[model samples]
Target: MVTWQNIDTVMLDMDGTLLDLHFDNHFWLEHVPLRFAEKNGLTLEQAKETLMKRYRKAEGTLDWYCVDYWTEQLGLDIEMLKQEVDHLIAVFPYVVDFLDAVRSKNKRIVLVTNAHGKALKIKMDRTRLGGHFDRLICSHDLGLPKEDLSFWGELQTIEPFSKQTTLFIDDSLPVLRSAHAYGIANLLAVIKPDSKAPAKDVGEFKAIQSFRQIIPA
Candidate 1:
């Protein structure tokens, strides 16, 4: 549903857009809760309940995506924990072909993720997907989550692109809304972010089930 010739830059999210979200979903939902339960002397259900409440409180904030912040807050080495499950990191279907086609067409493909640097590096190292992008950015370095309007302006200061020619794809509706507000002309969402979970409801936005659907001409 995208007009390839009209798009100049292809900005993508990491966890849900370019990469399969199963790694992240399983990490937070199963792995962390299991470990937290063990450490805190609680049942898995209890740990999940407790952590979910805390996660909701931090949702959409930079702290939500901050490894250091979660490490300090949870009294856990969040980075180390992620490594224990790093083997699960994987790219989504047809992502490489999509990136190659876009690059071949000479469009600027950028990864704009909210993942902390450590988390970002771990996935990049594991998947060897770093070479596909023209630039990689973490909201932690920007000191604001993509959900914030200021993030767009701050992003432009460093990696400049015309808002009207940009195609921004993300699974997070809040972040997409912020991008829309910042005048990003083309927006798309992911139908299924977490492969193990049910598809997300992408209200009022166009979405893709696979990047294979939008490969550039």
Candidate 2:
């Protein structure tokens, strides 16, 4: 579905695109709510119910991905909480091979993530995948979420990529839609971001279950 010959820049998402999304899914849906419930003396169900409402409200916004915002809003040390589950962090299958293949082709590989700096550091420390990328960009650095079309414009000022020759891959459909609207020539979606969760239906955009499908042997 992609024309590799026409692509010069490969923009990748971290959490679900390169790394398994299970850690994040478990953290927010189970771990955080459990801690919140224990701290407030509420039942786990109550905590999840309350937190899910808040999460839905912030969906597609920078606040949804900001550790500091959640920490302050929830009155909990979000960074420390992530560290507690750091062992769960993992890269997806064949991701390393895909990176190697892309690099072998002399493509500019960049990580464009909405993950907060603290979370990014934790995952990088655990996976040691930082050395493979040309640049690491966090949405927090630009004060704009990838869901916002303007984020592409701001990103260009710093990274200077040609929209007609760049390929962007992300698990979040909203972010992919934003990138598409910004005129990114190629867009791919992750159908199975969270390994523990069921596959997703990414309408219109091409989707892949594993990076092996895109990388040559």
Candidate 3:
């Protein structure tokens, strides 16, 4: 639950918050592995096992979300691969309505994402959701991931907002926890980030299944 009247800034995550995570989930889990297997002459299972291990190593770090880093590490044209599957990128249910509702109330909507610049451009090009935001930020620009506490401070230097009056919505619990630690008063979690996956059990934080749940009447 959120008090819209008290909130002035809405920091949204792109991949899992505004956009359905199915495309990303499938891209990394299925498509990437398949291509890696083909390029490396390994079996699909072997490629998945190898890539998953590497992914875990970079978990919670900016490298995990960097297309350039992955491209060099995996010897694949990561950006090109994303374009091949750009058709799958999609906005979630009622996201536009919620954006419109926030705009109508004159709230500042900022897309604060951990997505790499290349990935962000591809998604925004397909969805055209950039026009709805007051500012668009990629963690890459700040040289820090949203999971890092320092990122919040760096973000404030450019796009200022009261920590207590801002509502940060994200699908990643770790990122939300970092924001909480940085003193962001309002936090909301996406219960179901991936349309193809099951709902997550988010403890403590208020969770929403869709943006429709928070849209003002």
Candidate 4:
């Protein structure tokens, strides 16, 4: 059976890894652009197309997560808008038990996400996942997305863990590819993100439906 027998450090993604992704999906796919359109007196399609294009242009950069960047581009107070839907933040199924299992085995649990400080704080405040982590590392804090090789360098400089023994779990395929290029020993992909959807593509890591599937009994 798959297990992390000798792993010393476990890195987790906050959004879809430890928390439910429906909230983020709904916020980005439904709420934000609609509100932006309303505030700017634009049609929904016009606002979504424009903002999505801008975000697409910033896909691999830190600007993608910057609320200030969105505020300047979309002409809306992104923070306040986020607060409007903040109650949607939720922990994923069996995540707390998985985290508890890892900690019970004395593994170092680190939260490695590409979320912005303000956004991360909103989720943390609402979900309490912060209390479970040994360190909360964000791409915004590193000034680069985790998909950049330079980000791994910055992560090592700050956290100082051996790549051969570190384990990381995330939902983004691109970010997982970046981690593989950096030689992380173990990687996991949250495959069945929606229990209701059919199987699609698996990322650079081993795909699993549940976090508990990988934890040793």
Task: Report lDDT (CA) for all predictions.
Answer: 0.93, 0.94, 0.94, 0.82
Model 3's number of clashes is 0
Query: What global local distance difference test value does model 1 have?
Result: 0.93
- Positional deviation of residue 203's Cα in model 3 after best superposition, in angstroms: 2.1
lDDT of 3 by residue, 15-44 (tens): 988999999999999999999999999999
How badly does each model clash, as a count of residue pairs?
A: 0, 0, 0, 0
Candidate 1 regions with alpha-carbon error over 4 angstroms: none
Which sections of candidate 2 miss by over 4 Å?
Answer: none
Clashing pairs in 3: none
RMSD of 4: 1.7
lDDT of 4 by residue, 1-217 (tens): 2457768899998877787777877777678889988988889898888778877898878888788887787777888888999887778778888888889989999999888888899998888878888999988888889989889989999998888888888888888888888888788888856443455488446787887787656
Model 2 Cα lDDT, one tens digit per residue, 49-168: 999999999998999999999999998999999999999999998999999999999999999999999999999999999999999999999999999999999999999999899989
Query: How do these models rank on lDDT, best leading?
Result: 3, 2, 1, 4
Candidate 1, which ten residues in sequence have the lowest lDDT sum?
Answer: 67-76
TM per candidate: 0.97, 0.98, 0.98, 0.93
Q: Which stretches of candidate 4 lie over 4 Å from their true place?
A: 194-200
